[model samples]
Target: MPRSIATLLFLSVLAGATPVLAQPGGTPMQLPRTISVPGSGSVTGTPDKAQVRLTVQKTNPSMEKARAEAVVVVQRFLALTKKLGIPEAKVRTTSAMVNPEYRWDQPTSRQVLVGYSVQREFEVEVNDLDKLGALVEGAVDAGVNHVAPPVLDSTKRRELNRQALAAAARDAEANARAIADTLGVKLGSLRELTAGGAEPPRPPMPMAMMKATMAEAADAGGAATYTPGSLTFDATVNASFDIVSP
Candidate 1:
C-alpha cells in the first residue's frame, strides 16, 4: 500500500510563453503550450469469491501402493467438491506424479531407498465466499495434507478496474487545470491522453494465520470462520491539456 497519493504536474512552458524555433527556409515554428500531468486512483471493495490449492500425498514401501493411495485420496476430494455444488471445471488437477524416496546412511556412506511417494495437486475455485471455510475443512478431513493460502477476489473486478481508471483520468484533468491557473493561462481542449492499466490487488495472508485456521478446522469439525477482506485496484493516467490563453 502507498503511504501518500498525489498527481505530478509537468508544464510545457512555465512562463506561459511558447518557444519558437527556426525551421527550414527561415520559417519560425512555435511549440505547443500544454500542461501534462500524471494521476493515480484506487478503489476498494469486499471480495465475494475465493480459490484454494490442495494436495494429497502418500508414501509406501511399494510404488504401486503409494500411487494407489494417492489416487483414492484425490478421488475423495473430487467427490467432496462435487457434493458441495462446485462445478467440475472449477476443480482441476494441477499435477500428479510419483517419485522414489531416499535416505542417506552415514555409516554406509550410501543412499538407501526408503519408499515411494505419490502426490497430486488440485486447484478449486469457490464462488460462494461463505462456503470457503467449510470447503477447506472438508478437504483437510478428506486426506488433503498440503493446502495453500486461499486467495480472495471479487466478481466485479473488471468493472471496478474501469471505475478506477475513470477516477484517474478525472484527477489528471484536475491537476492540469490547477497548474494552468497557477501559470495564468486559460485551459483548452484535451490535446493527448494515455492510460495505464489497473493492477490486481493481492490479499495479505500470513503463514501463521493459515496454520491457525487449519488448527481450528481440525478441532471444530464444522465450517471454520473466515473473513473476506477488502481488495483495492489501482490505476494511473497521463493527460495533456492545450493552453488556450495567457
Candidate 2:
C-alpha cells in the first residue's frame, strides 16, 4: 500500500476511539451521578360506611329440620335489616353449612352420627354510620346471637388515594433535594420516576366483646354515642435525579 493510504486508515481508527474518552466535563452528557431512594407518605381519613358479620346456628334431630330453622333465622335477619333501611344489595349471605354432630364411641372405636347442626353467616354493609348501634341491637333482638362488631370505612377512598400519591411525590422530591444538598451538588433534570402500587385498605382492630357489653349497658341509661375512628392511607415513590457539580 502507498504511505498516504496507510496514514489515512490510521487517522480514521483514532477518530473512532476518541468518543470512548469523551466525558461529562466537556458538555452535559448522560452520566450516572445520582442515587435513587424510596420515600413513603401517608394520610388519614374519616370512615363513612360500616360492615357487619352475623351468624345463625341451629340444631335438630334431622338435617332437614336444622337447615329449615337456619333458613328462617336468616330470612328474619334480612327482614330486620330491610326495616332498618339497609338496602338488600348491601346485605348478602356469605356462608351456609349443614353437618352431622358426631359422638366418639371409645369401646367400639367408631364415630356415631348424632343430630345435625346448620349454620348461616351473612355480611352486611351499612352506609349510615349513625344507625350502627341500632342495627346491632336489632340483629340481637331477631335471634342473631353471633354478630360481629361493625367495621367503619370511607366510601370516597379514590380521592384519598389521589391525595396520598401527590403527597408522596412531594416527599420524594424533598428527599432528593436533601440528598443533593448533602453531597454538595445541584439536582438537575429528573432521570427516572416510578410509583408504588396502591395497597388495599387495612381493616381496623375489632372492638373487644367487653367494650361492646359496656356500651350496651351505657345505652340503657340514655342515648349512646359512638366515636368513629379515622383511617390511614399510605403511598411510596422511587425517584432518580441528575446530579450537577457546582
Candidate 3:
C-alpha cells in the first residue's frame, strides 16, 4: 500500500545571468543572451477513484498447510469482492509471500523451525465511494488481517496536469516580463522551455488518523466510516527567452 509520490519537484531556473569565462584558447567566450525564470502552479480537487488494499496472512506447523490455509482466505476475499459487485478487472493480487517461522531454543542455545507463514495482498479499485466503508468491513470479515488506509485518485489526471502546466508557463512569462521591465529592456520571444512531473506527492498516514479509524472499526464491526478527501496537484516550468531591443 505504499504510494510513490513525487515531492513537488519544481524546475530549477537560472535567476539572472552569469558571464562566460575564458574559452579553451584563452579567448573571451560569448554567453547566450537569454532570460530564465522558475515558476509553479497548483490545483485542488476531489479524486474520482478509491484504492483499497488488504492482506491475508496464515501460519501453520507445515509450509503446505500454511499455503493451503492462505489460499482459502484469499479465495474467500476474492469471492466477497464478486459478491459486492466489484468488477473482476478492478481486483488483483498485488503480492504473495512465504516465511519460515523460528523459535529460540534456550536449552540448545539455537534457533529452531516452528512453523511457516503465508501472506497475500490484494488491490481493489472501488469506483463507488458510498460502498467504501462497507467494502472494508466485508473484506476484513472474510479473513483479511491487514487493511491499508484507502487511497483516492482522479481519472482526469492528465487534464488537471495540463492545466497546472499552462498556469506555470504563464507564471514564468509574467516573471520574465517583470525582470525585463525593471532592466529597461523590451520583452522578447521564448527561445526554449523545459519542465515535467506535475503531480504533488502526499505525506504518509498520520498516527492520530490511524488510531481514530481503528477505533471506529472496532466499534462498528470492523467497518470504519471513511471520507474521501481532495488531492492537490502542482506543476512547474523553466523558460528562457531571447533578449530583444525595443
Candidate 4:
C-alpha cells in the first residue's frame, strides 16, 4: 500500500501486534527458537619456510639479443641454486614474456618503437630459514635483477589451524551459555555449527620478516639478513543453540 501504511504496520509489529496466520486446523504456526553467536580465536608460531620470486629482464633493439640475454641470466640463477644444494622440485619458472618497448615522442606526436624487452620470472621455496638470506644474495649475484619480497610460511599450519578451531568452538559455547543465563533460559542442543571468516594470516605483522628492495639486497655484500617472526593463525565459528525454558 502507501508508505504511511507500511510504516504503521512495521511499527505495530515492533509493538508486538503482528498478525499471525492460522494453519489449516486454525492453530497458529510457531517458528523454532534459536540463539546464534559469533566467536573467534588465534594461535601464534614461528615461520620455518619462505618463498622468493626472482626475475631477469633485458631490453635491446634486437628481439633475438634480448631473448638470449634473458635466458643466460635465468640459467645463471638456476645454476647458483643447484650449487647451494636446493632441490630441483622446489624451483620452477613462473612466467616469461616478450614485449615491444615503446616511448612517447613529443616531436612526432606519436608513440615510437624503441626496442624489445624480454623477461623471465621464477620462484624458489626455501625450507630452511637459515639459508634464506644466502639464497636471495646468490640469486641477485647471478644477475637476477628483480626480487620480490619473501613470503614466510609455517610447516605446522594444519596443526595451528586445528588448535585455533578448538579455541573458537569453546568461545562460541561460552557465548551461548552467557546469553542464555542472561535471558533466564536454558541452552538446549546445538542446532547448527558453521565455520567461516577465517583467513590465512598476511605478512608485515609484528616480528614478521619481509625483505628489502633489490638494491638493498645487492648492497648487503654478505648474505642478506632476515629476522624470522611469529605468524598468527585465526579461526571464526558461528553457532546456533536451541532456546529452552529454564
Q: Which candidate number would show the highest lDDT if scored against the true structure?
A: 1
lDDT of 3 at 108: 100
lDDT of each: 0.82, 0.74, 0.76, 0.79
Taking the tens digit of each residue's C-alpha lDDT, what string does model 3 give over 120-227?
989999888767767776777778888887777878778888888888899999999998777766667999989874465533244367558757888766665566
Encode model 4's per-residue lDDT on 1-246: one tens digit a residue. 668755754454334343344579999854445768988888998998988888899999999999999888888888888887889999998998999999999998999999999999898998987777777777777888877777888989989888899889889999999987776667889999998646557463222243453246557555666777788999999998877643
lDDT of 2 by residue, 44-100 (tens): 898888888999999998998988888888888888888879988999889988888
Off by over 4 Å in 3: 1-32, 202-223
Cα lDDT for residue 9, model 1?
Answer: 19
Question: Candidate 2: what lDDT?
Answer: 0.74
RMSD of 2: 9.6
Off by over 4 Å in 2: 1-30, 197-201, 209-225
Task: Count the clashes in each prediction.
Answer: 0, 0, 0, 0
Error of 1 at 77 (Å): 1.5
Please give the lDDT score at residue 26 for candidate 4: 100
Best by TM-score: 1
Clashes of 4: 0
- lDDT for model 4 comes to 0.79
105-129 in candidate 1: lDDT tens per residue?
A: 9999999999999989888988987
**Error at 19, model 3, angstroms:** 10
